[model samples]
Target chain A: MKSVKAFAPATVANVSCGFDILGFAIDAMGDYVEVFRKEEPGLKVISIEDDGGKLPWEVEKNTCAVAIQAMLDDYGQEIGMDIALKKGLPLGSGMGSSAASAVAALVAANRLLGDPYERKDLLPFAIVAEKAACGAGHADNVAPSLLGGFVLIRDYHPLDVIKLHVPDSLYCTLLHPHFQLNTSDSRSVLRDAIPLKHSTIQSGNVAGFVSGLYQEDYELISRSMRDVIAEPYRAVLIPGFYEVREALKAAGALGMGISGSGPTLFALSKGAEKSKEIAKAAEEIYQNIGLGVDVYYSAINTRGAYVLEENK
Target chain B: MKSVKAFAPATVANVSCGFDILGFAIDAMGDYVEVFRKEEPGLKVISIEDDGGKLPWEVEKNTCAVAIQAMLDDYGQEIGMDIALKKGLPLGSGMGSSAASAVAALVAANRLLGDPYERKDLLPFAIVAEKAACGAGHADNVAPSLLGGFVLIRDYHPLDVIKLHVPDSLYCTLLHPHFQLNTSDSRSVLRDAIPLKHSTIQSGNVAGFVSGLYQEDYELISRSMRDVIAEPYRAVLIPGFYEVREALKAAGALGMGISGSGPTLFALSKGAEKSKEIAKAAEEIYQNIGLGVDVYYSAINTRGAYVLEENK
Candidate 1:
């Protein structure tokens, strides 16, 4: 194919008890990337759209360009490629915007190279792009975006990413308040040392949550979706955080927690209707705080990144 | 029935990554308790056997007697009961010996009182018995001993115990070297606070381990069977721990870890043959150290405590 266009879903990481380990993909919003093969021996970003002029225009700084470059370096190909990125997810919203961009680009580039690598094999390249984007090659977001569905990053040294079972009727609600919590600032609010008691509780919840998924027990999932390590400290950075959580809980969300860091929150429920209701409740809370909110409801996405279009 | 005799299986707690929360019952060694209804309105310990005469004979301090008393107190029964205890498991062997005694006693007393409470309802009584015996009501041992199979003690305050899926072919090998590490001394060696980095790794292993159990993926189970928090410090308490772990791994054991405290070690393998081999390897390691060791091999026990006999 002369050209390829791909889509990668957004993801919710630090999923309550699964901080730094668990994440899931959402079907509501994502990023799209189109890569064009060129005869000229160079790589460049031809255009970027819907980024509100905040994303970098330079090729080395952009997630898509960096991801494609990583793929090209590993493939040892001197071929030229032009890239176009369209952002459906908001930047700095804890919706895995950068990861989606990088994953989408890698998906397109791999297809344009005549499928040199399988989908799961593209993770390292995506991690390289993540390192270029956020100073840490965290696979929590990138793995789900690339592999789809629920993912557990079992280990990092060798990059073990496991795809876990997702209940059929599970739905997610994302509420992004109109503000920004820098990832570094959000991380700085966390304690470097945690009590062993809290660690044990967190492990129990993690085990319970995973068990609930396999058993398809929604009540167990709700009871297990608690974040003792990060949410308590990060909640203080977001206005009306606890109130919004209570509102979501009252509105029938199974559980709610900070999606990635702050300024955006996510919840889970049994059906799309309950998810929508939760979104409405969260929107009202953000509205009461005099901040606009963007809400999206979706079932858990089982398909991660895919080729949207191809040209002969 | 005027008298009832019951048996409770032994258990291996901590199960690697699930320290303070996870355990599984084994079908090998256990404790037996026989409760006889009497005319007077008091509780008494009539006989004890196979306990090396070290076990307390007083009704107040004995585990079986204490457990039966807790059940009677909760049942609000003004009846006399004579308890006969027989120990199949060693004392201070890290094999849930005390828990087995308490569970066996509770099972017998429950049957003698016509079973007002279901089997699972006996957990709190078992915890009370544990508190009387060890000064803390830790449920990792008692939960599996009472509920059977694998269990997760998800919460302590409300005392939530969850039964987990145990792979049908899973077998256990227990190696008890000739020594005793006091539970309090083993606990005192652990750090009260752990770095957040270690906690995250621990949570990842716990989630992966549960997922592996449900999926029945033995390779994943082996990979996830790691204890970063407790094993590092506790390994020093047991001589030749690291070498024995390597031998178990080489002998095709899926994973190995300290049973509950120290001196006793447990390894999990897929089949009976592999479990026996692992046991042999562990035995050689302890024998070379000039210590006599006791080894038991059995499949995962699905039935916890049961009535072995009844008299009319």
Candidate 2:
């Protein structure tokens, strides 16, 4: 293929009791990348759109360009390519905006280079791009966005990632308030240590949540979606967090928590219809607080990054 | 049934990353309790055997009598019962010795009282008995000894207990060194708080281990059997712990860790022959250290507490 356009979905990481370990993809919003072959034996960023000119265009600084460079470095080949990124996800929304950009670019570049690597093998490249965008190279977001479905990063030293079973009817409602919460500020609020009592409870919930997914037991899932490590400290950063959580619980959400780091919140339900109801209920809390909120509700995206169009 | 005899299997608790939440029963050794009717409407410990005269005869102090008392109180019936205990497990060997006694007593009393409660419903009474034996009312041991298979005490406040899927070929090898580690001393060594980094890794392993069991992925189970919370600090209490662990790993054991607190170490292997091999490899390490050890290898006990004989 001389040129290819690929799409990658947004994702939610640190899912309730699964902090730093679990993440899942949502189908409602995503980013797209287009790559074209060029005569020059190097990569170039030709254009960018929908990012308010805030995203870096320099190949060394941008997430998409960095991911392509990593892939090229590993392949040990110099291939000419011109890239264009169209960002559909909002910046600093804690919805994995950078992960989507990196994943979309990797998919497009891989397709343009004769598809040398399998889909799952592209994760390390995306993680390097994440490090370029943010300071940490974490895979909770990139794994699900690349592999689709629910993903658990079991170990980090040798990088063992597993795709988990998702319930058929699981739906998500995401509410993003128009405010930027710096990831560094959110990390600062957390303590370096947590009580052993809390850690035991948190691990129990993690085990229970995984079991509930395999058994498809909704009640067990509801009871197990508790966060004791980070939420208690970071909830204050988001306005009306408790009120929004109570409203979502009343609207029949199986569980609700801050998606990624706050300013954005997510609630999970059994079906799309209930997800809509939960969105409406949760929106009122933000509305009463006088904050402009954007809401999206959809089923989980089981197909992570995929080709949109190709020119042969 | 006027007179009934029940047997409850010994258990291995704090299974690696599942400290304070996960446990499983072993079929090779257990405790038996016999309950018979008496004229007076009260509970009494008529005799105790095979305990080296260390167990208490008082109804209030004994685990068997306390569990029967709690059951009778909850049943709101003035039933008279005389209990006889036969112990097969060593005391304070970190093998759920008290849990077996409590479970066996509860099973026998429930049958002698015409079977008012289901097998799972007797967990709380066992917990109360555990509190009477030890200071804490934790269920990691008693729950598995009563309910069978692998058990996760997901939540303690409302007592959410779940029976997890056990891989059919999983085998256990337990090694008890001839030394006692007091539960209080074992607990006192643990800090009230753990580093957030360690807790996150621990929780990741917890989720991965549960998923491994459900998926029947033995390699994943082997990879996720890490315990960063308790093992590092507690290993010093047991002599030759590190050496035994290395030997088991060399013998193709999937994982190894302290069973409950210390002194008793357990290794998990994929099959019976491998478990026997692991047991032999582990026993040699203690022998070189001039310490006596007891070794037992068995399949997981899926049928927990059961009636052995009844006189109607």
Poorest lDDT segment (10 consecutive residues) of candidate 2 chain B:
B278-287
Candidate 1's residue-wise lDDT over A1-312, tens digit each?
399999999999999999999989999889999999999976888888999999996879999988888888888878799999999988989989999999999999899989999988999999999999999999999999999999999999888889999999999999898887899999999999999999999999999999999999999999999999999999999988888889899999999999987578999999989998988888788888888889889999998999999997
Instruction: Evaluate residue B189 in candidate 1 and report its C-alpha lDDT on the 0 to 100 scale.
Output: 89
Candidate-wise lDDT, in order: 0.91, 0.92
DockQ of 1: 0.89
lDDT, candidate 1, equals 0.91
lDDT of 2 by residue, B85-137 (tens): 99999998888999999999999999887889999899999999999998899
Per-candidate chain B TM: 0.98, 0.98
lDDT of 2 by residue, A1-312 (tens): 389999999999998999999999999999999999888888899989999999999999999999999999999989988999999999989889999999999999999988999998899999999999988999998999998888999988999998888999999999998888999999999999999999999999999999999988888989999999999988999988888889899999999998988778888899889999998987788889899899999899998989999998
Error of 1 at B226 (Å): 1.3
Q: Please tell me which predicted candidate would have the highest lDDT against the true structure.
A: 2
Query: Model 2: what TM-score for its first chain?
Result: 0.98
Residue B134 lDDT in candidate 2 = 89
Off by over 4 Å in 2: none
